[model samples]
Target: MADHTIGTVADIPQGTRKIVVLEGIKIGVFNITGKFYAVKNTCPHQGAPLCEGSITGTILPSPPGEYVWGRDNEILRCPWHGWEFDITNGKSHYNPHQCFVKTYEVSIEEEEIDTVTVDTYPVNVEHGKVIVTV
Candidate 1:
């Protein structure tokens, strides 16, 4: 893994998306509810920049025989085609088998955001902000 320093934690606000260039790759960094996540900036459905999409919650089916519902708010909706992706795993909610985006490892150090790459890009969170380093 390779590490890179992108920016400070105050740069990104919660529930907003930011785009960065990491290792010449376009990456999208999101600060959702004080947490950070990273994924490919482009949407696979129509090649749109996912950073401009809507951030919303997702409903998941409970385990069999359970009459409860589990919900997650880490989903990003594509602006062009409305395709939804789970930010935590970078997998498409609509087509779980074949659709996925490149996700990066993120960490913080001394209130500074650091990103680690895994053949794709690197992203991190620092001081409550999101950062991406290519």
Candidate 2:
């Protein structure tokens, strides 16, 4: 796949998402705890716009009659049918490997600057700018 630069890390906040259209294909780029993930905007179930769906946590059964919610902003719920999908790998909650949405690889490009330390050792430190390539 060809690499496309969506934006810098500052463009997307720590708990938000951005949608980028590449060659007529809409892809969702999400930022969860500073990590980036990309997924196809179309939902597998009914072709709904998946990226427009709500980013929420999963509901788990804590006991016989109790339910607990966790993993906030880790799950994407389809707006049409409420189908939950993992944003990290686009794995559907219902049929993990059998049914799922398409996911793209996301990478961060950082520039390095050379500097000298007190011990006379050369050090390369990352600049503030971060390029998000997908």
Candidate 3:
């Protein structure tokens, strides 16, 4: 596994996401409530650009005649098929067990790094950059 610097925290504000390509693999990095999360941009249903979808919440289950809106800005919806997924876990809202999108680990680097080794060579980078591990 290797770490790739996607962008800075300021690049993606809170409740927003940024699409990044690491080694040709497109991934979506999201910032929710000051924390960071990442998921593959490919939707499991039809390979749609999942990250490009809306960053909104969904209607939760309620009583027979009631509906509740919750998880604001934590849902990632596929623009192609309306497939909804949790940005925090990349799990499909329909069926979490069998249907889901690939997720990646994200980290915020604040330490002074000597060099960033990507693939094989070292790339010079500064601190406080968001890194996605693949």
Q: Highest TM-score: give the candidate number.
A: 3
Clashes of each: 2, 0, 0
Q: Pick by lDDT: which candidate is best?
A: 2
User: Which portions of model 2 show Cα errors greater than 4 Å?
Assistant: 111-134
Question: If the candidates were sorted by their lDDT against the true structure, best first, what order would they fall in?
Answer: 2, 3, 1
Better of 1 and 2 by lDDT: 2
Which wins on lDDT, candidate 2 or candidate 3? Answer: 2
How does model 3 fare in lDDT? 0.87
Return the lDDT, model 3, position 124: 52
- Order by TM-score, highest first: 3, 2, 1
Model 1 steric clash pairs: 22-134, 23-134
Runs in model 1 deviating more than 4 A are 62-72, 112-134
What TM-scores do the predictions have?
0.69, 0.78, 0.79
Tens digits of lDDT, candidate 3, 9-121:
88889888888889889988999999999899899888888899988898888899898999999898899989999988888898989898889899999856688776854
TM-score of 1: 0.69
lDDT of 1 at 63: 75
lDDT of 1 by residue, 25-126 (tens): 888888877788889888887789886788887766777876653434588889988999988789999897799888887766687356876686688999
